[model samples]
Target chain A: MSRTRVQHFSISLDGFGTGEGLSRQAPFGHAGERLHAWMFATRFGKTMFGQQGGTSGVDDAILSTFAVGIGAEIMGSNKFGYPGWHENKDWTGWWGANPPFHTPVFVMTQHKRAPLELEGGTVFHFTDAPPADVLAMAREAAGGRDVRIGGGVRILRAFLKERLIDHMHLVQVPILLGRGVRLWDGLEGLEQVFDIETTASSSGVTHLMFARKGG
Target chain B: MSRTRVQHFSISLDGFGTGEGLSRQAPFGHAGERLHAWMFATRFGKTMFGQQGGTSGVDDAILSTFAVGIGAEIMGSNKFGYPGWHENKDWTGWWGANPPFHTPVFVMTQHKRAPLELEGGTVFHFTDAPPADVLAMAREAAGGRDVRIGGGVRILRAFLKERLIDHMHLVQVPILLGRGVRLWDGLEGLEQVFDIETTASSSGVTHLMFARKGG
Candidate 1:
């Protein structure tokens, strides 16, 4: 069975999961961008982004997991990298024309925007549905694969509140934005146990995979 | 004579920032929020956030610098942490009624919003202003008091590109989101020199600082 899993999420040492203000120009801001620098230069990203001469090695081995086992993806509107509801809504998002996730994507948004259709088998579904509704949707879309509880912050916490997560994968980079949009803002209670797997990248990013207790 | 100096910022050996999905619930998420766990409980942050009864000592000293000598502040719209532009033109940002910064705040944005007046001596100015313009604003506002270039990656990079930043404070946390956003996207061509200052918090986050060359 596919329990809930939060795959490949990074956190900052300042106890902030993400740097504040993820905007178009600086999605990750200051040290925020350094978190994923390793992945971009990796063979996986280069190949996906259609760049030539990408390096291959252990890093590539790690990069391989980025797309391997996974069913559907979930994220907040900001996580989708799109801001605001426009009249036309023609913006295909910041990923140029094609985005990496080519499957059904569940986007969390409060407003009412039509679902987005993309070239590479990607469809954006906007929902004001509850976390449970979204998760249920993701699981069905997964088709017995796995669910990626992708996100901004609030979306992820929605699932974590009920312990609906199964696995978490993150790449922690060596940088810090003292304070901005910190990962931990309102979580003062609730406890968790994480089985962690870690590795340091050549560019100095640390990759980790976490699994919740007992499936 | 500005030397490259890194300060106050912290990170982890594994590079996971506090945690992914910085929302009100899990806050730092799992081991993620643990990034800044050491600071909020310290003296400086307590004072800044206006709380009482925090532990003081080594951690307080460290926390102080994150706020100390901060003559001015720089941030992008994202760093502002307001819900969305749809809210209203007069948004004062996430810092409570009275914000932490008592100086001029330079906000970089595409849309020009009206300047926000805050409870304390804080005024928010929006400009499609280039990084140079923003820095000029910050420096002018700084009045020789040494400005703190605060932000997510894009704002920082824009400043870095112009070589206008004087000192950078970073905290490296050990939490990784394999893919979400990376900090160095536009870092390819920017020129920067690193002078490192290392400090460790109880939560295992590493603090770093940088002062650019030739301020």
Candidate 2:
């Protein structure tokens, strides 16, 4: 069965997935690379960025599961580019020529544009449909593989609120980004739906896995 | 020099120190015993509550610091009793005759009342003063010993915002309380003030210790 999964989604100690004032220059604003420093230090992150020499520990083990069975990805518009990416039609994404996502990437946006095919099997399809409908489209494109929910916090909360996520792996970084869009704002009593487990890594990030119960 | 410390403070993965709807019947509200379950299973908790035989590990080692070298405790009114405890003059506290705090405890409340001395060394002094003023009074009563900041969430956040805490130990339980008074609210850039360290315990709770830099 094809499952919807969120892997290696990092959040601050205060539950902020991304800090405020997200711009083209400062993608994560005041939070900078603090929330994602743990991942960048892992072997999986180093290999993903075409770099060499990184720690191969518990953090690397967890991050390595990110692209295993992922056949399609549904990312928030913010995850693709800055706030005003729509204004610049020529803008592709932060990922240069060949993006990491080798599958059909669905970008949830109000301004739908022509389908973009980048280098290395990566393709961007824009749509403004609701989560369920968009997810259905992504699932069909997954081709028997799992669909990944790429997040910037808001979109992840939306899918989570509707219980669309089957398995979620959230990394809780120790830094406190006192202000930002919080991921757990309306998710009160989330324990009722998902069986949660936590593991602390030596890199100062706690890995939390939430699997939907009876799904 | 007497230092202000916080220990054994349990919070949900969402950074909620206590859940909503706190009352005399449900102290932690919807959170129940889920947050403190990690501590209850520790050897220190078993001995503190007059029980026998509990696990002695990282959790027990952390929980053991609760009563050590602490002269006086300054806690929020919510920690002392349920909301509107001033209406019931006879209501002492939730801890019956002998409470765990064996020192002068100053309870911050708007409706100040006469001090209530319990069976044990716990004496509750009601004060409407701010954190700094109350800390002064507690320090004097502490008699050259360190003062502890007993919390219910709001008080702890207040002290943290003012940069009054010297040492803080927070246990991050796996559960998620979606709705509650958040502890990290308005405490933006807290990493700048303290050096934070994390340790994941076998009991599934991550211990986060924040020691004030150069303190």
Candidate 3:
């Protein structure tokens, strides 16, 4: 059984997973854009945008870990698009022309959309299938590499609830929305254990890596 | 024009700005619960639960800032008690006999719910009127002291969208829900200029005070 890893997910100072001051147009809100400013300012970020001459720092190192060279990525509907979870097959990935998930990306959605082909092998497979199934396909697509669970929050919950997550790398940034959406609710006590593997960063953003104590 | 402070909000890495996870229930989502934990772990927190002998730290200090010798506080209808945007008037404060806001706390709502006097000076008012109207009520209630806008999201959005918030304080904690609801979504062109005032902590949590550059 292959394991799933959640990497580089950042949060506002207020504990929101995402979507604090969000709308259909902005989606991530003002603060959320700030949460990831550090990510896109690095060498790895430049590579994603087809730019050159970027610096390598804590941000670069972290973003580089999420590259196609490292793992396969998975996401939920919310991360893929907007609200109105009703059937809308026309919804495309947020990134215009070329999305960052150039590798095979698995999206979790009840409404199925055709596999979207873009620059690189970024074939977005939308499935109404269960998280386990999506993850399984993602693992296969990853080809023995680690699978990164990209999120909008719901997808992360599904895996966490089932204890399917192996390593979680959280990049907590400094900024609070106070209210919007949150990362921790309901799933409190269920024998979920994670051991801190590392807490490293150069920017104000702190990266925390936690894995099963023994696994 | 009296300035309104939108305190303690959350956000995610992608800027989705919402926490509403389907399986996730009540008051945002996973991140919503994280936002509450800081207050819940404070001495003022114990005071709210009719207990005592709680520890003090940045979290406690922030809580004390609101609990002891405070000015006034405000909460949206969702945080006050009522779930989502229901026109019903049965809901009151989330706290049972006593709520954390010991001073006068204003409630933002559309439907009118008869103000029920709690054990403390905490008062819940229904202002379906407008954001500015509620702000006026809150300022008047504060007399000459500062007013804290305790929020869920929408209420914060009203002020944030209107650019009415002055000082914004966010407590960044480490935890992930993966998905429930979000905080900083849909807020575009917020044009907020902030000054990082103070920083300190307890319980691995950091307390950051951002005074809107002008205010």
Using Cα atoms, each model's DockQ against the true complex is 0.03, 0.72, 0.06
Q: On DockQ, who's better, 1 or 3?
A: 3
DockQ of 2: 0.72
Best by lDDT: 2
Kindly report which residue stretches of model 2 are placed more than 4 angstroms away from their true locations once superposed: none
Which ten residues in a row are the worst by lDDT in model 3 chain B? B15-24
Give the interface RMSD of each candidate: 9.7, 1.5, 7.3
Model 1 C-alpha lDDT per residue in residues B11-93, reported as the tens digit of each score: 33333333345443443335454556567877776777678878777677766766455667777776675326425654567
- lDDT, candidate 1, residue A56? 77
Q: Per-candidate TM-score, first chain only?
A: 0.85, 0.98, 0.86
The Cα error of candidate 3 at residue B137, in Å, is: 2.9
Each prediction's RMSD to truth: 13.7, 1.9, 8.7
> Which regions in candidate 3 have their CA more than 4 angstroms from the true location?
A1-165, A170-210, B1-3, B7-35, B67-70, B83-102, B113-126, B171-181, B189-210
Specify the highest-TM-score model's number.
Answer: 2
Per-residue lDDT for A195 in model 3?
54
> What lDDT score is found at residue B71 in candidate 3?
67
Could you give the CAPRI-style class of model 3?
incorrect
Q: How far in Å is the alpha carbon of B140 misplaced in model 3?
A: 3.0
Model 3 Cα lDDT, one tens digit per residue, B59-123: 77666655333467777766666355354344455577766566777777666666667776777
- Give lDDT: candidate 1, residue A137: 95
